[model samples]
Target: MNRPTPAADRTDRSKRTTGPGPRGRTAGAAVLGRAAALGGLVTVLGLLPWLSGKDPALALLRARSAEQEPTPEALAAIRADLGLDAGPLGLLGDWAGGVLRGDLGTSWVSGAEVLPAVLSGLGASLTLMGAALAVALALAAVLAAPVCLRGRATAGTAAAVLASLPEFLLSLVLLIVAGVWLGLAPTSGWAGPAHLVLPALALGLPGGALLGRLVADALPAVLAERWAELWRGAGVGRARIVRAALRRALPSLLPQFGMVAVGLTGGAVAVETVFAVPGIGRTALGAAKAQDLPLLQGCVLALLALGLLAGGAAAAVRRGLLGPALREAALSLPAPLPHRGSPAVLLALAGLLAAVVTWGLLRDPYAVDLTARLAGPSAAHPLGADALGRDVLARLGHGAATTVGTAAAVTGLSWLTALALGFLPGTAAGLAEVANALPPVIVGMVVAAVTGPGTAAAALAVTLVSWPPLAAHAAALAQELRASRFLQAQRALGASPFWIATRHVLPAVAGPVARHAMLRLPGVALALASLGFLGLGAQPPSPEWGLLLDESADYVERAPVAALAPVVALGLLTVLAVRLSHTAVRLRPARPAPTSVHTEGKTPLATPAQ
Candidate 1:
């Protein structure tokens, strides 16, 4: 090749100088793409009601006007009055203009500015989240010490038990025991710091169990690595080594903690309902049921912001834990546990089934209260009375019946959907991925628009939105398992694809899929309660925990125990379900041999080699 002239080299250098580095250009492009996607999502959310073919005029007239049957002329008049007759483009313009001015319009139900309502709810939610996080982290830190130092199984067991407890169920149990059993804390509306105690613990403990277990397991594993032995040989104190191990393991735990934080926030729907605590999550449930577009949009946006904040904090914490030297390594962690199963599911199912039978055979939940409007718990009315003077115990029994039946139905339907669709290939993956992208809240709203509010609508909503994630996961696992040698041998032997799938692939993945389905049940429980709280699930006097919560709020101070009975019952059921999921996951062997040594049992990294 001929050497380039000095003048040619100078021109080439100038051209290179003006171009950006690869990463810089890539990041800029990503930012722009995200902005465009967000804008599109906003437009879609703003027009969701119209997109669903729900008529705002009819909805408003039904909610606001006294006339049971309005004439066509009246309906048209109301539509114009609300300016809901605007075309899609026009509505978009109006909504965007209001958004720019920091206004979210008035709520159809409350007739108040959306900003104030959202802000009020935000304050309560922030308080709950802050308290819950503090409690969880503190408790976990303390519990972690024993596991890191002595490999205490008790600490891990505690975490497992608590993590399996449902957030709502925990709140309910605490409320009843504290307010009714011992007459300890105020269980009704938020008054002062006292009210925060039980809810905070309920919200925090489930997360604490997870954090403590991870921290405990991770620290021991870190200590067992080869490098740690060097420090041990150098006569480094065990305490210092423990601290070092913690610093390494902590970085890995923060991301999960962030998820726990979000769960605490979203899971607050149950806690807030039980305690009559006004929070954005509860407000979102309300807006969805009423089909209040502006209020629901505002709540969704606020929650999205909160989620982003949690994510940012987790990232920052991860970076801090990584430090400069370990920065590269910290970015990478374990991908996933390929297989996990638990046998506790059988125990949980049996226990819950027994409890359901007991509740049904014990009393009638629909018996009306004849004595007092809101009586305290006593022999006559063990759970007390509602505002309508209904027997709290009877309603609770009926609620247990309704709640159990609904949960079982939803779980079976959702599990079958996941199994059927996930077993397929091409079309199943694409469909699941699409469903995964849509928010569950939006799906609930859409379903409500079609079916109106009832147990059926809520059940459908939960089943539809919940199955996609599980299906996507199961399908992916199936795809991975199909590549194994045994499956391949069957395939090469001329076995039909369907036969191989059923006989081999299905059983191989069934353990993990079943556990996964169980894990999703607590979420389903929350969805049911949320829909009920929002007036879309169990109607009044139905005894569904969600409906019980809604109907009991006003009478909290009057008959705290009656108002809280459902919380206790629902919480126990939820705790059982969670335990079932965890137990199910634990039953599967991690290695080919059940007795194979695990990382937790391994000696510390600093220990001398044999």
Candidate 2:
């Protein structure tokens, strides 16, 4: 037998020499390690007290009773049981260790296993989300297909208007009209499928608006492509062309749909509350208000995981459908040349950065102020002010900025956090799956109750809710890219996990991630504003849109413009943001051609020759 080096060995050698910097791997490892540590902390918070007989409920009870009288022995026992006897640092260390071992405690109120309690609530939420997603997808298929194929203006406009309606408002209307007025379903309660309709509609309507736009916008361009044209000439029928069209459109669309699904999962929290559903969102809301620490922590973990799962599923679907294309595309990109800084490249980057900052500043939502207070569109204020003597323009700008900024920041942070959570060796996938099925608003409300409302709490809440999608996306993309030969080759060469994730996986996912990040901004803002409007966020004098709505609720008759202005502004901002991002992504340069140098020079390429 001829002795030869194994293919894996050769590949390993090649990758070791070609992979990313040692410094990047070290840094990524550190970051991911911290993430794992934090997840441990969260999980420990879930399990520690219950296992030790000092659960959140008992602790609260002990504290309350102690305040009322001198319960020294009881207090000492509670402290001992909680391992407070070990001191804070020791307590932290012990908790961290247990968490690493997957000992998430128990629900304080229910005294149930954290995972089971979370899963129970998650089951209901997922059912609702599934129903909503099914409806939304069906609607998108029906409405978007016609619009894309023919620009069916009427259907398109109706779709647009349908999407333009706010989720809470829509839910309320449906609940009243269909559930109460028509007596078709219960107005509240977590009964069977009937209880799902209004909430499903609430979730689906906004999602439909987004999906319809994505399909209508993405499909037309894909259909207009040269491959689609060639397929037509090759005697492919319209139905087949449409199916083929999905391949091109999906890479762009799936990521976005995933983000929206992540967001809608969070939005369902409030809807669940309104409808008195016993899902995680409702449970979380109650837990937050009651200061039920274990329950709240569990809910946050669950939401984070859920967001990741949804994002991951979308990524998986995309990869399944387009894996071959992605693999081929990876092969086509020019290998990175040695990094000598180029002035031209630097200038282009700087100009692009400047343009972005400038656009954000000019659109500084806080600048538009209406001078009159509750006045119906006087010359000075196009959109009248509300109860406070603030400028409508100024308030609108601030609120818009608040909504957009808060949502963007929260979504980004949570996703990053979730990425960290999912980066762990084994638990990430399970955590993401659990998180995808939880409700975000419930998490938000719970956090609000604990940390106190205002931006910080809201941000934390949003993070808990939003992080999972990012995790899911990153994880799935990582999984997909792993199938690429470039990656397989690198891995065979001994490239570390961090190296693969950061250098190879990240670069490929940058565009899709950025597009999705932009897509989710409006929804986050909407959720924040809606929460604020309901007096569940931002407190008084923040100039937030939701707060303005709350203040103007009573004055809708006295000055309709003040109330309607904010509503209109919120709706317009969301729709425009969706449109702008969708357009920009659709217009991005196509991935470099996957295959090159066709042997037959005259043979028709998938893309037409100019």
Candidate 3:
């Protein structure tokens, strides 16, 4: 053996301490990439007024006085006053400088200081989210306990069903059932504690259900570990064993909790809108509708920061849970086992969806009858008539196509983008994380600001934000696959990277990613519907499901069936998506489990009687 010289040892130690290793370089690059992405987002937001192609000065003049017409002198003075004459770069610089100084500027429409208004809205949203998170954790414990203790199938099924209901639809149901009929909670406003109940429940229930399912799936694995068996053999109490198992399982849940937190932030838009809570989500939607660029920018930036903070907090908590010993360890749980449904149940759901579509397609969704406005369900209108006397059944039928079709298109585009970027070496991961920080509603607000609110803008916004999850999933799977023995064998045999990726990696990754995307279809549809409900997608008379819901909300007490029609349709759609996504997973070919671990260049041989 050769010994290192003293100078060499010192040089090696210095290099170990100071050199930028692969991990260090990756971290630096990720930070720079995130910074660049954030800067680019701010720049785009700053340029929105110019991108809209509408003269802000003229709009301001009209807003100040509708009868006023724009003149060159007046326009020049207004532009100078508003700092528009400084051009896009100058405006961006000023906004960036203001942000650094804790000044968020002012609302163009309301003339209110943006910082205070945004802070107030953010406070309301944070309160709602905090309450919602508590509800979620409590619900998760309740739902997971039965499954963990008794392996109850019904508990899991209940979780899945509850998780399938979109937040907006659930909010409406809770509003009607709890607020209107039972009078257990207030229907709207953020005046007191009672006002928070329904909205928090609407947001929390689904999240809790989803979290429960994940916990249920992961806890069994933790309980099956060798250490758990040892504890049980030592005559430990069942409750004590469970407590230890839960602690062991919790770190696996942190990523999901982060996602849930981010989801709650995004779901606030529809929930707050339904409940009339003056939160940042609703404020951003209102700003988009009013073309208040400054206010919208502030709201979106605040949301972005909240999303990042949530992600970071979850990471910190996970690190704390794992402790120093296992800080760098990667742990993953098995996917939830697919639920098998009876053929009769599947047929019933299919029939319900088909009947609604066929019934609506036969009638004219656009036709109006003033005399029968807000009519109850009858022979002429199977579902009832809306405030405009439009056939609710027909609109439900046509709106399914508008809503589902748009969601499908967005999903396909997003899936394609995910596949394209999934294999990138270093940058895709960081970019995906940055992109995931933006909620679809915030993106929709920006798109609507530029293109005007419509189905196209909704689709674009959803597509932009939707790809990150799938891309991240794909990248992770691809990374794992690349390190497998079979892939290494192919590499040893001199297979080209492209050939191996296409032949081996693509097949391995695509099915799982596709199923993941399919599982997200209902979310995509809900997002589109949320935008429509906010008047940012599929405008009136288009018979879009969300637009129909928005239109029926005013007359819901008188024409409950009108609202119920679309709600049922959306619920059924969500159920269908959940069923199909799971069915696809179950139907996929299963890969054989490895019998033993293999070293790089070694094979195990029998010990031959030792």
Candidate 3: stretches off by over 4 Å: 1-33, 61-70, 147-154, 334-338, 476-520, 583-610
Q: Write the per-residue lDDT of candidate 1 for residues 406-517, one digit (tens) a residue.
A: 8768877877887776665344444432233333444455466556678888788667646654465556567667768988888899999989888887887676767766
Local error of candidate 3 at residue 248 (angstroms): 1.2
Evaluation by lDDT, superior candidate among 2 and 3: 3
| Residue 133 of model 2, lDDT score | 86
> Any runs in candidate 2 off by more than 4 Å, and if so which?
1-59, 62-70, 84-117, 147-166, 176-185, 323-450, 459-527, 534-536, 540-543, 548-569, 572-610
Q: What is the C-alpha RMSD of each candidate to the true structure, in Å?
A: 9.3, 11.7, 7.8
Worst 10 residues of 3 by lDDT: 601-610
Instruction: Residues 425-522, candidate 3: write the lDDT tens digits.
Output: 34555665666666667788899999999999999987877776566666667777888999999999999999998999988888887877776676
State, as a TM-score between 0 and 1, how close model 1 is to the true structure: 0.70
Per-residue lDDT value at 379 in model 2: 50
The C-alpha stretches of model 1 lying farther than 4 A from their native spots are 1-44, 51-83, 88-101, 109-112, 173-199, 273-278, 315-401, 416-451, 464-476, 487-523, 530-535, 548-568, 587-610
For each candidate, the alpha-carbon lDDT, in order, equals 0.64, 0.58, 0.76
Ranking by lDDT: 3, 1, 2
Candidate 2 lDDT:
0.58
Q: List clash counts for every candidate, in order.
A: 18, 27, 0
